[model samples]
Structure formats: structure tokens, C-alpha cells
Target: MAAKRRRPAGKGAGAIGCAPFFVLIVVALIIQYWWVLLIAVGVVALTVALVRSTSGPARPAKVPPPPRPQPVVAPPRAVPTGEDLTAQLRAHKRISRVRDMQEWDYEWIRLAHPGKSVREVNDIANTHFARGRSIGINWGDPSAP
Candidate 1:
């Protein structure tokens, strides 16, 4: 007859094999003093909770409230001077030669004139230049004329 061979115990198999032994010991202890076991379990739970609370980081006492916003006050509009107007007109002429002026260009012009449209500003600048105004801009070009 051949002798029987035993297989090596695995990690899971060893823990599973010892489970019944541990359960039997616990059963015997519980049978002896059930109240003591219950008290021990409660004491362990309280000690764990106490250690966690004491060992962890401390919290802030109180959070600060958000600040209230102040009311906005717009500054007064500056009055454009004659020299400023002349400089702006010259610049406008140069820009108009390159590309057709946009709404933003007219809006900028309206900043100086307050209520004039793009066409009105163009007419006004042309008439101002036509009347021999030396605004440092060349108005002799046939394309512009």
C-alpha cells in the first residue's frame, strides 16, 4: 500500500483552519462571563474614539464673515481739447485709409463729440479740414479729396 501525502497549507487555508479554534475559545469565555465581554468591547470602542479625537488636528474656533461690497461711483468725463480733437482726427484719417471704420471707431468719436454718429463725425472732420485748418494732416490727396 502507498502512504498518503499532505499538501502544504496556504495563507488563507491556515487562517480558515484556526477560525474554528478561535470561535470555540470565544464561546467558552462568553459562556463564563458574557457581561464582562460586552463591557470590554464597549471600553475598546470608547478608547479608540478618544484616541482618534485627541490625536487628530484641531479645528478653527470660528470662521470670519464675508465683507460687504461698496457702491460704485463713476468718475467725471474729461472735456476734449482742440489739440486733442485735431490729433484724434488725424489718426482717424490714417485708420480710415487702411480699413473702413467700425462701430467701435464711431463709439470712440462719439466719446469726443458726445452724440454724433460715424457719418456725422466724418462730415464734421472733412468740413473742419476743408476750411484750411492746419491739423498736421495731409488733406491734398486726390483719393481723400
Candidate 2:
């Protein structure tokens, strides 16, 4: 013989039974004093407002004043001496032989000829390097004897 299936108890049954009870209570309260419903709605709105206001950081009603601008002052420039210039040139030449010169090389040359453009400084530096080469200045590998 096959076993008979027993139904699951009290899942939706409790909610169905409580629904009528809740409806009756609300109806009784409405009949007794309608103003109570309005008061309940007002209290719910007040509660929501209080919760939202306290939930996060408070914002200012007006925007804060724009930040004050800081003054920018230029530092004093130092002039390179003849010995300093010669030393810098020698250092630059040693570096150039190792690798092809870049924009930074022209920038270094610009430090010596302050008013000159990058192209002009490059030309001037190239002339100096060429002149050194013609004079047989050893601007190659320092490791070489």
C-alpha cells in the first residue's frame, strides 16, 4: 500500500489568520478617532526625517569661501664662472660619447647661454664638441687606456 502525504502546517496559515485581526484593529481605531491616524502618519514622517538627518555627515547651508591664492616668488639665479662652464662642458662631452644627446642636453646648454633657444644652444654645444674633437681631446670611454 502507498503512504499518504501529510501537508506542511502553519506557513501561510498564520499570516492569513493575523491579517483579519490587524484589519479589525485599524478599522476600530479609525471609527473611534480619525485624528489618531493623522497623528500616526505625522509621527512616522518625523521619525523618517530624524533618521535621515542623523544618518550621515551634516552639510553647510552655504558654500565655504573660495581658498585664498598663494603668492609665487621666483628664486635668485646663480651665474656660472668660466671654470664651472669648462667643467660642465667636459662632463657633457663624456656623457655624449656614451649615448646620443637628448633635449636635456640642450637644456644644460641653455643654462650656459640663458637667452638662446634649444636649437641655438645645441648648435653652440656641437661647435664646442667639434672643436675639442679636432684638437684630439679624448672624449671617449674613460676605461680605455
- Score each candidate by Cα lDDT: 0.67, 0.69
Report the error of model 1 at residue 114, Å: 34
Q: Top TM-score: which candidate number?
A: 1
Write the residue-wise lDDT of candidate 1 on 1-145 in tens digits. Answer: 9999877676445657678889999899889999998999999999999988785577768978888888888988887789998998899898775343333433444576967777889876666545544223343233444
TM-score of each: 0.29, 0.25
lDDT of 1: 0.67
lDDT of 2 by residue, 40-125 (tens): 99999999999987857767699789999999889877877899989989998988853454334444567868888778887887
* Cα RMSD (angstroms) for every candidate in the order listed: 14.5, 16.2
Candidate 1: TM-score?
0.29
